[model samples]
Target chain A: MTAQQTLWSLKAGERCEIIGYDTTLAEAYRIRLMEFGFHPGERVTCLQAPAFGAPKVYQVSATVFSLDDDVAAYVQVRLEPRDA
Target chain B: MSKVILVGSPNSGKSMLFNRLTGLNQKVANFPGITVDVGTGRIQAMPERTLMDFPGTYSLQPISAEEKLAVGYFERALQDPEVDHVLCVIDATRLEKSLLFTLQVIRDCQRFGKPVTVLANMIDVLDNHGLELDVDGLAQTLQTPVVPLSGRSGKGVDELLASLRNPVMPDTNGAFANAPDALLRGEAHALSRRFGPGGELLVRGQARLDSFFLHSVTGGISFFLIMYLLFQSIFTWAAPVMDAVESSLGWMADALVPLLGNQVARDFTADALFGGVGAFLVFVPQIFVLTFIIGLLEDSGYMARAALICHKPLRLFGLTGKSFIPMLSGVACAIPAIYAARAIDSPRKRLLTYMAIPLMPCSARLPVYTLLIAAFIPAETALGGLIGWQGLAMFGIYFFGMFIGLLIAGLVSRTAEDRYTDLPFVLELPPYRMPGFKPLLRNAWNRSRHFVTKAGKVIFAVTMLIWILGYFPNYGADLGESWLGQVGHWVEPLFRPLGLDWRYGVAIFTSFAAREVFVGTLGTIFGIEGADENMVPLVDHIHASGLALGSGLALLVFFAISLQCVSTLAILAKESQSRSLTLKMFIGYFLLAYVAAVAVYQLTNALVA
Candidate 1:
């Protein structure tokens, strides 16, 4: 299988589509992810990543929100190559 | 009186709208047993009716404790015969995201046969972006009358008020109560696309700024600098205003001193009004400043980012990033800090946050700390006079309080069964807007006033009781011979293990109302001891008493850790909705403080000997 890219794999100016959430994560986290508009097929762009391995800001359509590295890791994403 | 409910998602300028509608007439009450604040304001235009502002929630699907409270209030309001009209505040910048709650409210309102008006708030947000919205088209689609207005600028507030005057019943024939959330979201997206203006240009502008704010290196530096300034402003900046307020109250007391014919009347007014309550009121400027700064962070949409910065470190202690704001503000006053905990989404984290807050070295503790340091710690300068011994001791005490708070939070958050069930970290980064000064300041003033009135009422009463007990029998002549002194003698044994005398016991006992009362209480006790003559400087009194250095240290430790403030307990009880938890925390912290104080006293006493 081809390698999977998570939200944490992206940096500032990088963009990707949310493939789906890691189902093995807690149910509450999944609900929050959806509530935050991180549903599958939604396009998202990485806005900024702070120095600490902390929450990174991302924008989807019009909504901008921060996702922690752990939670961001749960969201499977298809990323554009760095050279693209 | 008719009931008007204001419902909106978080950060929809719902509060600004409430401020515009109600002004300073807002009264904050607890929701029965819950810690939730129920703010009701009299509509000045229609004095017969009252407006109720609920906690901001995204949907009726109550995931978080805050959402549960908001939706719970909405449900109960639906059954209330008084609640007839609803105002659904929607952010104009993000109509699609807002419509979910808007539609949810409309459907529920339809169920209850109540009319609804769509308050398209923050229109100025759109106006600045040079975008235009077809308000009529959007209103037509939703079958609700949408009144476009900026809650910040108050541009269309008159029109919004006019709409509220004749509340229009929405033709919610198309709304379905059981419509799936996904369906609602899809419909909302479609509705925004069809009728609302395309508006990501403003949001894109926000991205340019977020790059700097959310940059790893610069963000961390900025966060520390802002927090440093926050604490500095609370201390150094508010000093002049605090001194002014104190002197004015002193002047008033002096003016009243001669007017009262009897010594009893003069002492009562002077001590109770001028000394006890006045000392507490002097901290009011700090509270105002604290709330204003927090309000600025909140309105400018920087709070979420602040939370993000603290998320990782805080999570180690079982708290989310959101708890940081409350924790920081806790350094100012735990009353507002407890209220600020409302912003935290997770119940467990919020509870733990409450546990950590009172332990924060709030400004109320400043008087006690300063007095103790002046009496005990030598005034030698260190680091080429950059830091005085007193300043260093003050820093140590403040650090100790916050340290204990973090330790408690870490322990509490770690041991919980559902520790990992944190609601996903998805704090919204709303586009930055210039903070609306009028509304923001109005909000800070109203909250500060509410604190003074509600919390102040309890403080004033407690102060009066302390004053009365301290004054009677000998009529301020012999405090040791007075009733309060007797109570002090009674509690003295309880504290004697820490080498404290009955006089210190009196100060400690009276300070249960608040920590700052320790100074005034001790002052009066010492005043009685000083040959019934002019009161000596408190530091000189302490020196002459030949009190053990260990006992001074013990008192500092006790005040640093103990949850002594009655208003804090009252707020904790209301917010936690568990009198048992409040009782448990009170007894537990007091016992903890006592044991710690005793240990410190013994250790130091042994070493000094």
Candidate 2:
């Protein structure tokens, strides 16, 4: 699925599993995500989406990180439905 | 001696590596036209060596003037025959992005024909992540000798040092063998094209981090909490050490007093030297502790997180996310904070941030705040032992600094020319890694030494000057009859409504050198010898002198907001490159201080009546 489909379509507080990174953007960013343990198969939780569609705050493991809309738009994840 | 310059992104552990190479031989100097510190140190690498820890930057490309200086230095060093090696430090955990800069360095080395070495720092962190690098593969790929060393654990330090001692030539062929597609094709570029090829990488790194960290709200909150913890830690962990310093000063004063038989000499020794200088000295422990923690956060790459976090709030103040790094540094000392503002691209905004930074209640303000708050506000527990009102009051004063900072920033932003649309908040959140102790200790020691050496000299000289002023005209005859006493009396009418005596006025004036001097100034004015607990005696003196509570409250408010330190002002002037801005900052702050104090005192008096 496209990055926009995964991040933008997901509701706030939704949990998702990282599928992989879309490497079309800068390699530095892709590597930075990898270094932060945001690899495929890791669970990620959408914490907050700022008003007027600002940056999104996500909880990856115990650490809280904020992603700008552009970066958020490049991260690909599979949304975990509420039940599972 | 051959000189090697260590350069890398912020939090890449470059300083840590620099310490490993240089030990305690490092000194911090300002790059011309900017406030960022360039740490230089001499290392004895098998008969001859010197290493300079350049200010951390994302790329060689210049975005702001500071990056330009760093890139400029890198190029100048390349051309200078005195410089022999360029140690390109990379955070191995974030090697992909780091390699991008490394490739640029290789390109620079090619252009300048300077020998270079790749240091894959934080190898220990990679190990912890269950990741291992093919150092040999990376070295071959980059055509450079890669030394996998952890600056924290001392692991591979000897090997790294050995490499420095016996330098190796960078393999020209492998240098750009593994360059990313964009860099190789020259497709992606940084905003620093204004400076030509020299600044491209630097601008790219900054742009990348700026996009993520500057505009994000969550990033802002996270930044606030990190800074809040940093400030909170200074108050919490440093207390015991600060108390020890206070006790030591008391001991020294007691010991010195008996040796000096003359009353004037005795009082000067106890009150002026020990009392004035000693009070400020007590904060050394807190300063060292805070500096150490900040160094760790910076070395570990968390400081970038802090900058990113505060970006949103800082932008409101006409500062970029990068401005928060310097402002956070300002908590320790405004000198470095002003320099840290070099990362901000906009000249006007940088000047405003630099001017307003000193207003933040730095560690120097702690002694003043502690003394005043102790005298005026009763320490009361509130709401099921969840909080101490005294602690809350202290926090409120700190909160007041931030509140005023934002208000001033917002006001300034309205009047100042909008240099550019707000820069994107893009920050690469570097992976969390453990900081090594040796580098941490070295940094702490170096900073503590600098504070004691530089700030201490200024404070010592200023204290002596103020002491001379307050001491002469025979205040010993009867404090009421002294020159300082007469001066205080002259000013007393202005302050009488606030319940302050001439002594309080003198103390407030002396505090302009450094805030903690107020404690000693009060001690000298009151002629109370060997009182480590100066607040009680001070309060008693004020109460017996018949000053109203309204005046006490007014003094508290004045101390809370007044721009009291000359060093802070000097730093502002140096950073902003505008004497008028510094003067305006002082005037604006002092005016606000007077207004706030007067209003608080009058209102409190009215409410009490």
Candidate 3:
């Protein structure tokens, strides 16, 4: 498996497993992300990248949330292998 | 009365369930954070019990002002002696994320020794998609009663009520109760994985819709089209109804005036009540249309996506995307728009949004805009009459108002005071559902009625005051010598820079009660000023009076930027929780409006010359 990439770096349709939070993330925001079901080891899929690409939608635990790139950068994830 | 607090994540159908259980028509939208105010109503079956609906939040830990508000209220309610039960609603289709919030709520309720019930809402969504949740197994795992129901279909409502009758507190020895705060997330994740619906079916269905809605090209185009439809509907659809209202009021006035024996009462009925208040009523239909269209956008889950689309552009203005909803609602009225601003996460952006709302050229401005445009601007059409010049002028004024709002918001948000402590932009996109027409109609009806009840009394009072002040002393013989005219003359120099006469000055002065009163005040002033043998429309009166093009344009600009509504100022004070901020904005906008009006009047006069 490759090293962690920020959730914002994943392309649409890319599937990834949450690894952990980047230490640089604000404490309050990190807690909020986790409470929104972005806990480590939880899987999420990139749903859509809106126009201009500041905020992107992602689905985790059947919940869809649009997070601005700044917020998305705090969530570390490992990309899943593409099915052939 | 025993209070039952309804708590849940945003867009979890919490408000809808509140409505179903209590039968109160509190606003529910697919967009999160619509319930910025606390809503309380008695349970339909049990009149003795009162249900409190709090704004939805992700967890007990809050990220925004409104979320903090909801959490604070919930924690406080748990300590209150009158509180009996807490219903933690979790979307069944989206179990894990919701369970995270549910766990926090259960833990909190346990700490307070208050009963908690896990309402597994939107199960019907799961059923239709051929999925299932083991409610009983989930109940056993959490050691709390889990009742499955749908807020949309009213399915399982009876079961929910039955469970409510004997609410049970989470067992003190339950797994979650003893689990530390950090561990509750994992427990919720594990429990949902075990008892949640087997597949990713719900996400798949919603993702299909998001593909088109969030696409770069189609999304932007649809967003503009929908917004244009919203703006256009307010004027185009409401035009006929406005005309009917105007004609009916005129008909009523014509029929009733002769029956009055006294001349003073006759003129009062005709000029004050009908001319002033009745003219204001003509624009109420526009408010109805605006509310209905906004409600449609909100309930369809498109408001969040619109915010997403607007986020980048709005960011350039030092505002976030959530500001879009309130700013657009401002186009309808500022009172609800101010309430809507609570949803914005950032304090600075919310303040900027408040500054921008009053400048949105609301429906109250429509009458003055229409009257002025008809008087000064030509009704000639271009493109084979498909586009009237008057319509183009209207668009220009509306755009100008919004542009000025954005400009001021952009400027103020960049100041040093607002530089620190900004909240992150995080919004949920709830799955799209067909908007409930019944609720939409009810909400629209309530909004219109609210506008009338709240603003109506003010308009009525101002009308009477203007009538008595203008009608007496000469008894409709000469308006120039009447009491209102005397006051108008006193204020005339203030408006002299805008090239307006005393009559316009009086109307402007009286309009501080509400912007729409500008029209009614003008109607009364003109009715007394002309004292015409035949009834003439207010637009023609402006034309016949030969109002300067500069003055007409100046009046439009003045109304566009001024913070004139007393209700808006009151709400601004209440919501911002700062009377001083309200005072500053009120004074600041009026000065800005005066300077802008003077500039417009000079520029138009110079260009024409």
Candidate 4:
């Protein structure tokens, strides 16, 4: 069995296909994640960290949202090809 | 005579369209993430109908307070036969994102047998970018009446109103399964691809700017700079206007003095009317500037990011990101600061945030601090003559008060009972837009007027009581010979250990209603005691009193922590909504202040000797 890489593993300016929420998370948090298009198969790209803190900006398609490190770590994702 | 409910995802121009139709201005925030305030007004075009504007929400599943409120409105509106139609306005530019909510509203409205229309707002953007939307095609696909309108310019607003006059219910299948955690992404995606205009340029433009603004390095620096500018303007810009207001009040008070025959009436009219209300009125400019700047920041869609940036540091102090704005707002005044705490999602965090606000060294404390600093702290330069000693003292007092607030927050979080529900730190970052000034100015004006009226009444009553107390038993012959003086003498022993006299005790007692009242109360006491020909400046009176440095320091510390303002207490009672919590804060802080003040006074008395 392979361990899944989460959105937290994505570095600055990286892209990934969101696998969905980590099942261990509470239902409210999971629902919120899905509500903002963080559901399975959505293409999410990490734009950058706000330079100082744990919260990083990610584009969930057209809408961009910032997630704290604690919560960001729970969003499972598959890494996409690096920009040439 | 049916109620037309305006519902939409936040910032979809729903409020704007409602405002246009009703000709009533609601607070239209640029920050779409904020909780919606239910605003109902009569529709100008259709006088027989009432229009209700709800908070922007994505779906029936509630997340934030606004969402909860909106969903509640939806259910109650369904129950009430008065709710005839729903105007679900969606941003035309972000159709793919908004269509999810649009589908939900359409489905629900149809189930309830209420007619609904889809106002595809921001259609003006399509015209500018050389783009076209298949409006009729979207109407056909959703089976809902779709009107391409710009809420900002009122473009195609007549078409929307005409449709509202005779709302044709959408033909959606009403098969939206009432799933608690429904994932409609697949359906929303299919709808967007079918009917969405593919407004890629706007999203791209937003991405380009967001990359720069949310960049780690630049974003942090810009956040600090903007926040600093915001606080700086509150202090510097407001001073001149505050002075102008104070002087005009004085002029009014002086003009009325000769008209009154009785000395007691004259003093009552002068101090209670002019001094009390005037003092509170002077703080309005600072509040105005703070609200304006905050509105601008919120409208620009940076408030959430700013809160996110603040989250890490605030969490260290046992607070969430939402506490940042309210805490910063505390520097200007705490009433609005208390109201601002509504943005916090967590109950515990909101309570913790409320505890810190009162100790934030509000602008009301400014006059008290300045008066004391001018009297005792010499204007000597320190640090190789670079920094003024008095200025440093002022800064120390403000920072020290904030330190105590943070310490209390940390303690509360540690002792607070754990909740079963784990409230997540999920914050919504709304897209930025140019704020409308008409509503922003009106918002600031309304808040200022509200503070003046609500808090003003309490201050006025308190001032009159103090006036009546001081005027009695001698008919304004002598303040030291009045009922207030007798009470002052009785309470003098309580403050005796702190080395303060009965007159100081009297001043402090009156000040319990409002902190700034200490200065005016003391001034009136001195004026009657000396029975002077001219009114002496309160600062000069303090200078002549030969107050011990230890006692002065003690009084300063007391003012720093004391739950002295009744207006703040009234606001806290309203905000916290728990009588126990409000009382606990007031009494708890009062005792903490008393002990701290006594300790400082005694320790200083020993050290100085």
Query: Which candidate gets the maximum TM-score versus the true structure?
Result: 4
TM-score of each: 0.88, 0.71, 0.86, 0.90
Candidate number with greatest DockQ: 3
What's the CA error at residue A19 for candidate 1, in Å?
A: 2.1
Q: Once model 2 is optimally superposed onto the true structure by TM-score, how far is the C-alpha of residue B330 displaced, in angstroms? A: 8.3
User: What value does the lDDT take at residue B147 in candidate 3?
Assistant: 91
Between the candidate structures 2 and 4, which one is better when assessed by DockQ? 4
Model 4 chain B poorest ten-residue lDDT run: B27-36
Residues B1-609, candidate 2: write the lDDT tens digits: 677788887657787777767765778786566556778778745437778888776665555555677788778888888888888888765554455577678777766666777888878866764556678766665566788888777688778777766776654555453455346323112211111112123323433444444345645665567778877767787888988888888897887799987988898898778877776667667667776777777656667656545555566666665676666666665655664565565566676676567766677777667766776678778788789877888898887876777677778778867642333344545544456656667766765666566566666788787777667777466555666667778887776666676778777776788776677667766787634344677767756777776776677678767888866665566555567767887888888889889899889988999
> What lDDT would each prediction earn against the true structure?
0.81, 0.67, 0.82, 0.78
Query: How does model 4 fare in lDDT?
Result: 0.78
Q: What is the alpha-carbon lDDT for the whole of candidate 1?
A: 0.81
DockQ of each: 0.62, 0.09, 0.74, 0.51
Q: Tens-digit lDDT track for model 3 on B138-235?
A: 98877788999998899988988887897775666666666676888788889888999968777777888888888888877888999888767866
Better of 1 and 4 by TM-score: 4
Alpha-carbon interface RMSD of model 3? Answer: 1.4
lDDT of 4 at B530: 24
Which of 2 and 4 is ahead in lDDT? Answer: 4
RMSD after Cα superposition, model 4: 3.8
The alpha-carbon deviation from the true structure for residue B557 of candidate 2, after best TM-score superposition, in angstroms, is 2.8
After superposition, candidate 2 runs with Cα above 4 Å error = A1-84, B122-233, B261-263, B296-402, B417-423, B489-504, B514-553, B566-583, B598-609
> What value does the lDDT take at residue B238 in candidate 2?
81
RMSD of each: 3.6, 8.4, 4.4, 3.8
True contacts kept of 2: 0.04
